[model samples]
Target: MKTRSCFILMGRAVLALALSFCPLITVQAVAAETASASALENSVVKVFSTLRGPDPYKPWSKAGPQEVTGSGVVIDGHRILTNAHVVGYASQVQIQANGAGDKIPATVLAISRGMDLALLKIDDDSFFDSHKPVPRANVLPDVRDAVLAYGYPTGGTSLSITKGIVSRIEFVRYNYPVSGLRIQIDAAINPGNSGGPVIAGDKMIGLAFAGALNMQNIGYIIPNEEIDLFLRDEASGTPHGKPAMFDTIQTLENPALRTFLKLGKNVEGAVVLAPFSKEADYPLKELDVITHIGDFPIDNQGMVKLNANSRVRFQYRVQQLAKNGLLPLTVVRNGASMKVSLPVSSSHPMLIPSLAGNYPSYFIFGPMVFSRATSEFMNVPNGNPQILYGMAFAGNPLMTRRGDKPDAQREELVVIASPFFPHKLMNGYSTRFFSVLYSVNGVPVRSLAHLVTLLRDQTDDLLTFRFEQRDAEAIVVPRKEMLAATESILTDNGIRSEASPDMLKIWNEKTPAGK
Candidate 1:
C-alpha cells in the first residue's frame, strides 16, 4: 500500500513540475546555457608563432621569419594542442586564452608533421586554473549532428563560434603518405582556425585543420580518435606512426572481375591488383582477394562497417587493429580461403622525401651545388607554372620520377640545387640547375654521399657530369683545376662550409673510394 501511494505522489509531482514553468524557469535555463558556453569558450586559445620555413633554393640558409597565428584547445594533460603547421620551424610560440590579455610562453613538446598535429607545453600551471579541458567523444560524430566550432579567426580578437552540421566522415589523406579519420562539416572554417575544437553538444568531436576556401560549405577536422592515437604514441618515447598498408588495391565491383577470379556469389571483398614487393616470400600476392580485416567483412567496394550506418575504407581498421607491425587479414587465393598476417608500417622511404620540419642536406662542388631531390624542391618552382611546365616538357626526372620508389640502383636522387657561381670552371657549361646527377667518371651516382665520395677521391684528368634524363646536356671539366678552385669558390661565395654536416663527415673520411 505504501509503495502504490509513493508512485501516485511521484506522478502528482511530475504534473506540478510541468505546470510550474514560467519566467523564473526561463531565467534559470538561460543562466545554465550561459554557463556552459563560458566553459567551452574558456578552453579555446589563440596561438602565436614566429616561423622560418626551409629555403631549398638556398640550402645554406632558411627563409626569413614570418609571424603566424592559429587556434588551439586545452586537452586532458593541461597542454595546448594545435596543428603542426602553425608552429613548424617556430622560434617562439605563445598562447592566450579567450578574453585573456596576456600571452603565456609555451614550448613545443612534440609534433607529427604527417598528421598535422602538435602538442604545446606551458610552464605556467596557472593558465589551467580557469581553463578546463573539453571532453572528447570516442566515437565518430553522426552526419547532420549540430556542431559548434570555436577558434580565433582573422578579423577578430575574441573567440568565435561558427555553427554547422557534420557533412561527412571518412578515412582521408592529410599530408602526403599520411592519412587519418577526418570529419567534414559545412562550418565556415577560415584562416587562423586550425587546431580549434569542434564541439558536438558537450563533447568535442575533432579539431579544425583544413578548409576548402574555393568551395562553399566545406571544412575538415582531424577526429578525436586520431588525436587519441597521436597522444598515446607521444606518451611512448618513440612514436611509431600509425600502422598502414601502402600496396595498390582494386575494387571487386566488376562482375567480370568476379568471374575472372572464379569467386562465388557469396564471396565479396577487394582484389589486390599488384603486390608491394617482388619477393616470393611476401605474404600478399597479386590477384589475391581480401575478404576480411580481422573479423570485419569487407564489402566489394573495399569498405567495412564502422558503425550501424557508417561504412569506411577497409584500411581504416588497419589503424585500429594493427599490432607489432603486423595486421591480420582473410584472403582467398585461387578460390581457397586462408588467413594471412600482413606486414604494415607507419612510414616508408620515398624517392623524393618531404623535409618534414628539417632542413635540406646539400653539398657544394666548385661552382656547382648539389642536394637531394625533395618535395620542397618541387614546390619552389610552383610559384611559376612556366618553369614547372618547362621541366615537364623537358622530361625532368624530378617531374618524371617523383613517384618512383627507391631501388638498389639508387637510394637517393642528387640534383643540382642552385645555379653555378660565376667562375671559369663552368665558363661554357649549360645551366642545368635542377637536373639529376647520373654519374661522375662513368660511375653511377647512387646518393649524395656516393657523389661526395666519388668527387673527393677523384684523380682523373677530366670529369664528365652526366644527367639522368635522355637528351640532357653533359658537361666536362678539368679535374685538378676544379678541385683546386673549390677553396677559392667557397671564399669568393662567402660560404662557411663546402658541405652540410653529414656530407662533411663523408668528405673528411679517409676511407678508399669504393669502401
Candidate 2:
C-alpha cells in the first residue's frame, strides 16, 4: 500500500495539467470579467461631429466638410464633457449613448481650446434620465495604480475598455492650441479614445486625449485640475483664459552664474531672459533673478513645490492665477532683493498671428499678392532665409535694436506671397516670394492696412516698393498701369474679389473719399 501511494499523487498532478490546457475555462473567466466591466458603458457616449473651417491659403473659401468620431462622458448639470478638438469648428454634433440606437442632437455650451476641453448640452433632457454621470476624483492617482479607459475606440462599434496603470504625472506639452500641462499613462489610447474617461476605482481620474505615435502604450490625459479650472472659468461668467507668464526665464543651475548674480549660498532662482511684450511691463528686465512667485519659492531648476513631496515648474503658479490678475514676485536684481508685481495675461500686439484655424488675410494688387507673414508662412517648405530670419527676430529687442535705434517699430510683416507673374508692370525686377515689404513711397509699412493706406494716398506716377533685405531691392511700377490690370488678374486667377473681406472693409474705412 505504501508503494502504490505514488499513484494518487500522480493522478492529482494529471488533473491539474488537464485544467491548465482547457481553453473553455479561460474563455469563461474573460467573459465574466467583461460582464462586470459593462456597468461603466452607461456613463460613456460616442461623439460625432461635422466640421467646416476656413482655408488658410484661400481666405475667401471654406474647407470641405469632415466627419470625425470621439468619446464623451456625462458630467453634472445634464452636460457632456469631451475634448475641445472634437467639436471645434463643428457645424453639427450628435451624441449616441452606449448600446443605444438614437443619436441625440447636442450643442457646445462652452469650449476652452487651450485646455482641450469642451462642454455640450443635449437638446432633449430625457437623454440624461437613462445615463448616470461619472464621479470625478478629487486628487491625482499614484503611479502604478490600475485604471480603466472607457471609450468607443476605432476598429469597433460598441464601447471598449482597456486596462492600464498610471505611468507619469508632470508638466508635458499639449499638441493642440500649443503646449501645456498634461498627464501620461501606459494605456492603449487610440484614435477614437479621445475625450474618454480614465476611471480608477469607480472615480474618473483623467480624460484620455492624446497618445505618443513613436512609442507604444503611451497616452496623455487632461488632468482633473485643468478641468476644474475650465469649469470654474465657465461658472464665473467672465472667463478670459489661463494666465500667461510672458517673461522668458532660464535656470541658475551653474555655480559660476549663480555667484555672478550674487545669489549667496542657498538662494535659488531663474534669470529673466527678456519680456516678450510691452503688456508684460511690470517693469521686468533681463538678468532679474526670480526667487519667489506668490508664496511659492522657486528652486534653481525653475520649479516650485506643489506639496511636501512633489514639485512642478514655476509657471504652474502663474497658470493657477486668474487672467489679468497681478502676480507678486521676489527677485534679486543688482545684488539686491526686491519685490514686484507682474500682470497675468497672454502676449498682446503679437507680430506673428497663429494661422492654425483662422484664414490668412490677403490683398491682391495686379499680379502681386500681398499677405501678412505669419508662423504658418514661415513654415513653408524651402522658404526665404532672410524673410524667415526677419520674421523670427522681428521683435527681439536684444537682436533688432542697435545703438540709439529704437526697436523695429513695424507691427506686422507684409510679404509678396507669390513669384512675379509675367506682366509688363512687374517687369525689370526679380520678384522673390516672401520678400518683406519695408516701405511704400518713403512711408514705412506698419501693417497690411497701413501699406494699403500709404498706397491709396500715393500721388506719384512711379510707385516704389522697398524690401527689408541687405540689398534693399526696389520694385517700381506705374501707378495707372498697376490699377488698370487689377481686374484682369482677378478674372484670370478665378478670384472672386480683389481683397479679403476684412481687408476690403479696412480699405473702405481708411481710404479717402472720392479718390
Against the reference, the lDDT scores of all candidates come to 0.90, 0.77
- Per-residue CA lDDT of model 2 for 264-325, tens digit only, reads 88788889987644454556788999999877889999988765556678888777653357
Model 2: lDDT to the true structure: 0.77
Looking at model 2, residue 380 earns an lDDT score of 59
Q: List the residue pairs that clash in candidate 2.
A: none
| Candidate 2 displacement at residue 370 in angstroms | 2.1
Q: Among these predicted structures, which one has the highest lDDT? A: 1
**With candidate 1 superimposed using the best TM-score fit, by how many Å does residue 393's alpha carbon deviate from the native?**
4.3
Best by TM-score: 1
TM-score for candidate 1, please give it.
Answer: 0.93
Query: Can you give the TM-score per candidate against the true fold?
Result: 0.93, 0.81
Instruction: Estimate, for each residue in 169-216, the C-alpha lDDT of model 1 and write its tens digit.
Output: 898788988888889999989989999999998899999998996998
